[model samples]
Target: MEFFFYAVPSLMIAGFAAAAYLLVRRARRLRRTWTHGLTAEARCLRMFTTAGGGGGDTSVHTTVHHVYEFTTREGRTVRFEEENGPTTVLEGDFVTVRYLPELPQRATALPPTPGRLAVGTGVGLVFLGIAGSFCVGFILLVHVIFAESDGLLP
Candidate 1:
């Protein structure tokens, strides 16, 4: 029973660590791909409206229309849809996009900013660390609580 108690929490912590590592790794790879600049082409498809709350703390709801599109570049095509904001590209206009080479399907019209990427990655890793820690702590707490309640712990 003692061994199981230790083993279960250990496994939980290990699993959380692995998941957090994977997320950070993926974010880093994406950041790198953004830096290198992958080829992409974009064109606006249409526009649609969506509702959102307004500013001034008045909580006024309003509908806004934004452009949508089908973009193709580097042998991959994706719908470049935007909502509630004006896109730089217009309908029937061809535009270039940059993306991670590994994930050609995920393209962005904007250029990569290394500073922003670094900040984003750092923040993401921090958040992941916090989340993982919370998960591990929760798992251990639950196990200990249950064990004590059941008189399983000597």
Candidate 2:
């Protein structure tokens, strides 16, 4: 019982911290790639749907995958897939592709809408908030536990 009293909160704190880290890292990468990437005309090669889901307590979902290919100014052909793209796009349609010149393979099929960046940032901030709450809760828990042991908390 004592072990669980401390372990549960510790696990929650760790999980939230890890989630916040991953969210922030992804948000930063997406923002950087879109902001600094070079542009080229890419053609939609094909489209497919993939089954994706978060496990345990999360719901399962399907993702529409868009495969696009573009040729670099250096004549190198690069192909990439994106799950979040406008639904009106079809095979053979030309779209704007953004990529780092040095890493053309990591190109984006479509530019994010104005709200996309804000949404990513907002989600990351929420995760950070949850992590902060857990940290503060854990610290207070520890202080209360120790204070009770010393008869300072009654």
Candidate 3:
């Protein structure tokens, strides 16, 4: 019980911190790629759908996957599957793609929308909020447990 109060929060804090670090690293890498990457019009080849709902016409949750094809500056063609969650860009649609010039295979059909910085900050705040809530709840639980054990609470 004693270990539960302390160890759980410690693990949660560590996990959240690690997650935040990874998120920041990824955002930085993405920003660098976007800033120095080349752009091309990528054509959607096909879309695959995975349905995850079964309620006899009541639940209709589905995920759409897209495969895009684009050409590099060196006249080589590349095809990639994009993991766009719940958002479907129509097959045969021409979308702007960003790729590292030297490594054209590292490409994204979904360029970070215009306000990328703002979006990153917003996501960070949401994660922070979640972590903060867990920390606060754990602290309160610890305080209540200690207080009751000492007969401080009626």
- TM values, all candidates: 0.50, 0.70, 0.64
Ranking by lDDT: 2, 3, 1
Off by over 4 Å in 3: 51-62, 74-77, 85-88, 136-154
**Candidate 1 global CA lDDT score:** 0.61
Candidate 1 backbone overlaps, count: 0
The window of 10 residues in a row where model 1 has the poorest summed lDDT is: 65-74
- The sequence of per-residue lDDT tens digits that candidate 1 reaches over residues 52-77 is 66667867665544333444444445
Query: What's the true lDDT of residue 82 in model 3?
Result: 65
lDDT of 2: 0.79
TM-score (C-alpha) between model 3 and the true structure: 0.64
* 119: Cα error in model 3, Å: 2.9
lDDT of 3 by residue, 24-110 (tens): 776665676688888899998888888877888777777778888999888999898766522647888888888887767768776
Q: Which residue segments of model 1 deviate by more than 4 Å?
A: 1-26, 38-41, 47-94, 99-103, 143-154
Global fold similarity of model 2 (TM-score): 0.70
The true-versus-predicted C-alpha distance at residue 62 of model 1, in Å, is 11
Every candidate's CA RMSD: 6.5, 4.1, 4.6
Residue ranges of candidate 2 with Cα displaced over 4 Å: 1-8, 51-60, 135-139, 142-154
- The model with the greatest TM-score is 2
